[model samples]
Target: MAQSNKYQTGDQVKVRVDSPSHHYRTPTYIQGKTGVVVAICGRYRNPESLGHGGDGMPEQLLYRVSFAQNSVWDRYRGPSGDKILVDIYEHWLDPVGV
Candidate 1:
């Protein structure tokens, strides 16, 4: 099925910080962290739903987001050029405030 994406490449976005009672895939490390949308991986079933044996319908848009090491870790001791990439679903992302 075709779905519209709320973000595109180069768009700056932030991962949501939520503690849901159900199963979810977004890692704790990236929660509340900001990143850039590197690529759109198209829409797919929500993993949290699939993990629980649900229909996993109403697919969600997945995005390949890249973040600076320092952005993910405040005390990152690596090179300033370091980066970390993670695939995050649209539901877990939101626009960063100006």
Candidate 2:
């Protein structure tokens, strides 16, 4: 069965700022940061569960999220248009207005 994606390209989303004791792939630097969905990278097995020696059932939808450089870093000295793209799982993201 195919999983339905919660977000689409151009959707605004915020990364969840969670610090779980278990293994996770979401980077801490991008946590709690807001970004726009640039692409849907399809579904894949959950890495966190795999890392813990559990069967990675229930794949997760992955999305390419884009964030403004200045928004991600307080002292970013790059152009105002500069942006960073991060591959984030659906579980780590929340819709900006919902």
For candidate 1, the per-residue lDDT at 87 reads 96
Worst 10 residues of 2 by lDDT: 1-10
Candidate 2: residue 52 lDDT (0-100): 93
Write model 2 residue lDDT over 1-98, tens digit each, in one string.
76578999999999999989999988999999999999999888999899999888788899999999999999999998999999999999999987
Residue-wise C-alpha lDDT for candidate 1, range 1-98, written one tens digit per residue: 45568998999999999989899989999999999999999888888899899988788899999999987887899998999999999999999865
Best by lDDT: 2
lDDT of 2: 0.94
Query: TM-score of each candidate?
Result: 0.92, 0.96
**Over the full model, what C-alpha lDDT does candidate 1 score relative to the true structure?**
0.91
Off by over 4 Å in 1: none
Measured by TM-score, the strongest candidate is 2
